[model samples]
Each structure stands twice: as C-alpha cells, then as structure tokens.
Target: MNFFKPVAAVALGAALSASTAITAFAADTTLVISSWAPPTHGMNAKMWPKLTKMIEEATEGRVTAEIKYKLAPPPAQFDLIQDGAADLTWIFHGYNPGRFVATQLIELPGYQGSAEAASVAYWRAYEKYLKSANEHRGVKLVALHTHGPGQLHSSTKVTELDQIKGMKLRLGGGVSGAVGDALGATGIRVPAPKVYETLASNAADGVMMPMEGKKGFKLTEVAQHSYVMPGGFYRGSFALIMNQEKFESLSKADQDALMTVFGEPASRMAGQVWDEIDAIGVEATESTADNSLNTASEADRKAYDAIAAPIIEAAIKAATDKGVDAKAAVEFIASDMAAN
Candidate 1:
C-alpha cells in the first residue's frame, strides 16, 4: 500500500505539471497590436477587432491579440514596430516619405477606383513586380491597403483651380505636398493631429485628405466646403506589419494560421471597411446645411492632371534609382488598374 500511494502521487504531480505547461503556452501566444487610430475610426471600430477575432477563431484561440490604441503618433508607427515596441502596427507609407518609394505606385492619381480592387492589385503587384522583399527587411508585412479618393476641404469655397491658387493648404505628407505644389497651392506640412488647430488658427486655408477627415477631425464645423476632384487625385497606402523577431518566435502552427488569414483576404476586408467609412463621411458632411460639397470641373481636372503627370514621371525616375524596374512597374500598375 505504501508503494501504491507513492506511485499515485507521482502521477497526480505529472498531470498538474502538464496542465501548467499548457496554460503557459496559451498565455505566451497572445499577439500585441498597436495602432495610431483611436477606438472609433473604421480601422479600430470595424476592421482591427474583426481581424483579431478571425485570427483567434482560426487558431482555435491558440492565437489571440491584445490591441492597444494611440500607442504613438501615426508617423512613428512603422519605426515602433521595427524596434519591437509593438509586435504589430499599421503604417501609412506616405508618413515615412522616400522610405517606401517602390510601394508609392499605389498613391498616384487615376490608378485606382475602389479600395477592394486596389488592395488586391497592390498585393498582386508586390508579388509579381516588386520581388524586393528587401524593402521590408526586418519586418513582416501582412497587407497593403489604401484609403478612398482624397478631396479638398476648405474654409472658403473652392469650386475651381483658380480658387485654390495662393491658398495655404494643410497637406498630409510628401506626396500631398507635391500635389498641392503642382496645383499652385501653398502646401503646408502639418501632422494629422495638428490639422484642426492649424485650420482654426487661420494658418491654413484648407486640407487635402480623405472624406473620413470630416468625421475624424470635425472638419465640418471649421471647413464649409468640400471639393471632390476627378481621377482619384490623392490616396495613401497603409501597411500592416509585424516585428520580425515576434513573427519568427511564433510556432509553426500559429504562423500558418496567421498567414491563412492575413494577406489578400485581410487587405480586402480592411479596404471594404474604408469604403464603407468613406460613404459615412460623405453622408456626415452633407448632413450639415452649413457645409457645401462640390465636384471639380473637367477643365479644372485637366489642368491639375497636366501638373500631376510630371510628378508621376519624377516618381518613376526616383523608383528606378532605387533599383526598382520603374517603367515595367508603372506599366504593370496602369495595366492592372485598367483591367480591374
């Protein structure tokens, strides 16, 4: 009986040890995601949680994510992920100008119509044309998505190109600034967080951003006019990336699960969310009688396109210098957009 009791005690201890090990493994598998968008933005409200839930469900809860918001400013998001301050982050490619020259192909005017189409096209292009994963060395990119068309929101009515001449406008990043300059508007570089303050203080006459800005920044109260331009003049790309070390640390099963849900499918879902949010923004802007929305004239669009063409040419040249096949990439993107 004494020998039997010792054997039973050992078995019980082993069972408890196995249970503890399983629990530790479960706890360590949680993913940490950080984003600059507040909890209410479409990305935070509709997309991030949806993706996280999908990831968890796909892995049978073996993989989960804890999403933290506003961990840093929008521009610092990419670097934050690179340094492991965050396991994953959404990076606005335009925020880090010149760093993502190859990927900037998606930002050019007249290339995309719908977010869903563009998202898939961008992923396909990255795989087919830009084989240089070296650009994303040290980080694992999950998806590349872009916002809807950009429009002008101004304190004063801007119905034509001449109306914007000599006007100081708040621009998001380098491409926006370049577009603004090309259009003969004085482009003032201001971070998204500071746009409202600058607009209120008379430092800027207008801002060029997605329709979502009206809701995100409360532009309706400050800006009375929204000018829609032709040919999708301004759009920016966003990247969902994971830290290299964090990605490598995942077990093979977990990595496969993430890959199953992350790439084109995840991007398509996120892009649809942006499309829905963009419609909401337009509705919100139009709801107020104090605000006016107008589309640019054909002549105005033609004038702007003439200016933008050279910028696009220069961008292609810049990409060529960076070892990207500039002409082929441009032709590929254009043909893809045309086909889609």
Candidate 2:
C-alpha cells in the first residue's frame, strides 16, 4: 500500500508539470511588428492592435504579435521584412523611390471617397491588376491601404493655389512629390516622423499629408495654417507586409486562417482607423487657437484639377510600361470607390 502511494504521487506531479507546459504552448508564437511611428500615433495605438487582435482570433490565440518600435527606419521596413529581421511591418510605397511604381496608381489625386472605400478598392485592384508586377516579391503582402485626402498644411497661411510656388514643402515622394513639383513647390524629402522637426526648424514650409497629421504628428503645434483642398491634393499609399519565411513556418491551419483575415478585410479595417484618426486631427485643428482652416476657393480648386490631370496621365503611362492595364485599373478604382 505504501509503494502504491509513492507511484500515485509521482503521477500527480507529472500531470501538473504537463499542464503547465501546455499552458505555455498555447502562446506559441509572438510575431515582432517593427513600427517606426510614435507610440501615440493612430497607426501604433489603434491600427497595429486591431491587426494583432485579428491575427490572434483567426488562429484561436495560437499566434500573437507584439509591437516593437524603432527597430529600423521608415524606408528600411520593406527590407526588414524581407530579411526576416522582423516578422511584420508597414511600409509607405513612396519612401522607397523606384522600388514600387504600380502603387502610385492609388496615390493619384481625385479619388472621391473615404480611405475605407479607396483601400477596399485598392486591395481589389492589387489582386486583379497590380499583382502581376511582382513588386513585393520577397515579402508577403498582407494588406494595402491609403490615408484620407492629402492636403496642404503650412506655417504661413496659403490662400491661393499659386501661392504654393517656390515654397519648400515636405513631400512623401511618389505622386506627392510629383504634385509638389506640379505646384512649383521646392520639394523637401522627409519621412512623416521627421515632419514636425522639419517644419519647426523652418527647413520645410509645409507638408502634404492627411488631416490625421494634426493630431498624429503634432502638426497642430507647428504647422497651424491648414489649406484644405476639396477632394484632397493626393493620397498616401501604404502596405502591410509579413516575412515570407515566418509566415510559411506557421501551421497550415493557422496560415489559412490568417489569410482569411488578410487582404481586403485588413485593408478596410486600416482605412477605417485612418478615417477615425483623421476626424480626430480635424477636431484638434479646429479646437486649437491660432490654427487657421482655409478651404480652397472654387477658382483654386479648378486650377488644381487642371494641374493634376497631366500627373494622373503620367502615372498611368508609368504603370502601363510595367505591363499593367493602368487605365482600366484606375477606372475600376474610381468606380468602385464612388459606389462604396
């Protein structure tokens, strides 16, 4: 009987240890999400959390992600994901210059809708037309999105379209850089994180970005003069990417579940976050003293429309050169966004 008691005690201890190990195994993977934005930014505070939650739920809590800040610079995000330095990251197509040409299609001005509509259309366009380019060859492209209407934010008030000429403005590249050139502004290349410092130092007179910048980047403190253009001057293109090898390492079941949450669903979710933060930015701008909200006059709007026409045509030609039906893609996006 005493020998039996010893055997039973040993079995009980083994069971308890196994249970502990099983609990640890439930949280098997922690994806490192390398982000360059400030923690307070909507991208960091809301968008990443939402994405992580989706991933966790899809995989039944088997896979989770944690945000890691400043692991690399903004322009290096794509390479980071490709090199597997990080499991996931978001990238601005404009930041890498010639690395992404097809993405400029979404950045072209005059898309009439919220970021959510445009982003959903963007995902569809990527699957139908843009995927052929193979621009994102090494990394797994999870989602594509664009910010709300990009407009002019300045230190000094700019009332007319012509006033932009010769002013030094921070341009995030791609079509925004082209827009700056079209407006005769001396384009200053800087990442969004540097925008506040650039404007505060007077190195840049203004920046072209979404209204979210007011709250997201503290632009309300530096660039108080807002020259709002109807339909916005441009839109910024962004992509969520994951390390290909890391994604492949997941169980087939988990991988398939994650795919269900990726692409259009994730893109729409990101765009909705942008819309929410953009509203916050607008509220911050209006509430702050000495901040001026100047909408573009009818004549100025007409002038901008004329200026944007050639830029749009030029972008189409660029995509066409890459073996894509650029015109059809753009038209589809427009119709889809309008309907959305």
Candidate 3:
C-alpha cells in the first residue's frame, strides 16, 4: 500500500502537468476581424495594424488577429460578432439608430476636442456612466472612439450658416440627421460608401462627414466644397468590440495580458489615426484645384450657436430619457479634451 501511494501521487502530478499544457495550447489565439470600411480607410490601414501588433506583443505570441472585409455591412457588424460569424469588429453607433442611444452623447455638437481626446474621454465615460445602460451587452467592449468633426461636403460651396437650408444633404444618421433637421436641409439617408455616388449622380447636394471623406470616400471628386463650422456640426461615435465567448475562451494569462492593451489605450490608438487622416484629408482637398473648403464666418458661427441650441436640448432629452446624464457626459468630454 505504501508503494502504491507514491506511484499514484507521481502519476497524478504528471497528468496535472499535461492538463496545464493542453489548456495553454487550447486557447483560440487568432482573432478574425470583420471590417466594413474601405480597405484603405485608416480603421483598416492604420488602426487595425497597430492593434494587431499590440495583441501579438502583449500575448507573447499566444494570440493574433486578422482583418477580413465584407463579413457584413457597417450596421450588422455587432450582430455578426455576437452570432460568432466573426470574432471581432467595429460598429458605428449612428448606423443602428434606436439600438444605440447612449452613444449619441459623444455625437452632440460643440464638444471642443480632437478625436483622440474624445476617444479617451469616451472610454472613461463608458466605464463610469454608460456601462449602466448595457448598450453593448453581447459583445465584449474593447474601446470606444469618435471620428473628427463632421461637416458638409457639397457640390456647391456653402459658407453661411443658413446656406445649408434646402440642400439635399446625405445624412449619415445620429446627430448629423438632427443637425440637418435643425438646418431645414432635406436629409437623404445613405451609408458612407454611397455618399460619393449620391453626390456624383446629383441625387443629393452634399454629405455630412468628417474632413477625412475628402480622401477616404473620394468626396473631393464629387463634392468639391467643404463647409466647416467652428466645432463641427456633430461628431460620429464608434466602438471596437470582440465576440464575448471568443474572448472568454482565451487562457486567463493571455486574457489578462490583452486587457492591458484594451479600453482607453486602444481608443486613443484608433482616434489618433482619425486625427492624422483628417489632417491628410485637409491637405488633400486644399491641394486639389477644383476642390473648395470654406469655414463659417463669425456671424455665421453665432447664428449656428443659436441653431444648435434646440438640437442640443433634444439630444439631451433623448439621452436623459435613456437614463444617461447627458449634461455631465458632455461637460466631462470637453474637460478631458481641454486637459489633454
């Protein structure tokens, strides 16, 4: 019996060691990233690449990611990931409308900041306040971010605040639609990819998008004019998310390492790409002869301030009704940007 006891203990120890090795090897290390943006878009070209490298380094080769296009349309990305059709993806909150109201807090006009600041602040706000809403329940929220200020890109030059009235502007949803309604512009609903064709075919007068559209969506070719407001008409909010079950399947050690590179750090990475691309888009539009860029005059800005008041109130009401402290979130975002 004594000899059997030592033999049994040795066998148990060896089996436990083998089990640990198998568990380490069983972690699903490679993530499939589903993307809806154009292949050349910064979200693909710059943002995804940096994030992939971060995953690789932090996981010490235990995990990796790859980008796949056309897995689903922009709006369906969340469901696609949730259903395990894809392992990871980014979502535009505006595209889903009723399904995502809390995200609109970042979309409200006049948040004075760069994309990076807003993105960082957004993550903080999500953790502190937005999480209670449970807006992103199925997917594991990795980061929250925003694009550069959205402006009017049109076939005709628009400089004054009132010039936007009666223009057939392609509204990309969220607060941009609210801004269009406020300006009394006819809203033509379309996806970002369709904006070029919408303008080229004269189906719409212009589009509400960030300066990056000049390069990313080739707006300079169709929409020769850019009407920029003091703080932008509105900003668009986005989220980087992963399939929850997929995330949970990873080894605890690998999961811990991945967490270190997620959230605010990841948001800043994606937002910085937006800022860089916006600068490039600005240069690209100005460098082209036929393209025109116009900034609202001081009087026009004051008029815009007046126009924005009601829209702001509606946005706050919408958010507050959903149990978010819209005023506090807005003020926090502004202060975060100022601090940065």
Best by lDDT: 2
Model 3 weakest 10-residue run by lDDT:
21-30
List the candidates' TM-scores in order. 0.88, 0.93, 0.91
**Residue 57: error of model 2 in Å?**
0.7
TM-score of 2: 0.93
What is the C-alpha lDDT profile of model 3 across 1-340, one tens digit per residue? 4799899999999999999877655535779999988999878999999998888789876787889998888888999999999998999988888998888888888778899998999999888778878999999999999999998899888878888889899998898899999999999988887788888999998899999999999988999899988679999999999999998999899889989999999999999999999998999899999998898899988888888888888877887888988788777878888898
Q: Compose the digit string of candidate 2's lDDT tens values, residues 1-340.
A: 4798889899999999999777645777999999999999999999999999899889988999999998999999999999999999999999999989999999999889999999999999999999999999999999999999999999999999999999999999999999999999999998999999999999999999999999999999899989999889999999999999999999999999999999999999999999999999999999999888999999998999999999999999999999999999999999999999
- Model 1 clashes, total count: 0
Q: In angstroms, how far off is 201's CA in candidate 3?
A: 1.3
Question: How far does residue 47 in candidate 2 sit from its true spot (Å)?
Answer: 0.4
Error of 1 at 180 (Å): 0.9
Judged by whole-model lDDT over C-alpha atoms, candidate 1 comes out at 0.80
lDDT of model 2 at position 180: 99
| Structure candidate 3, residue pairs in collision | none
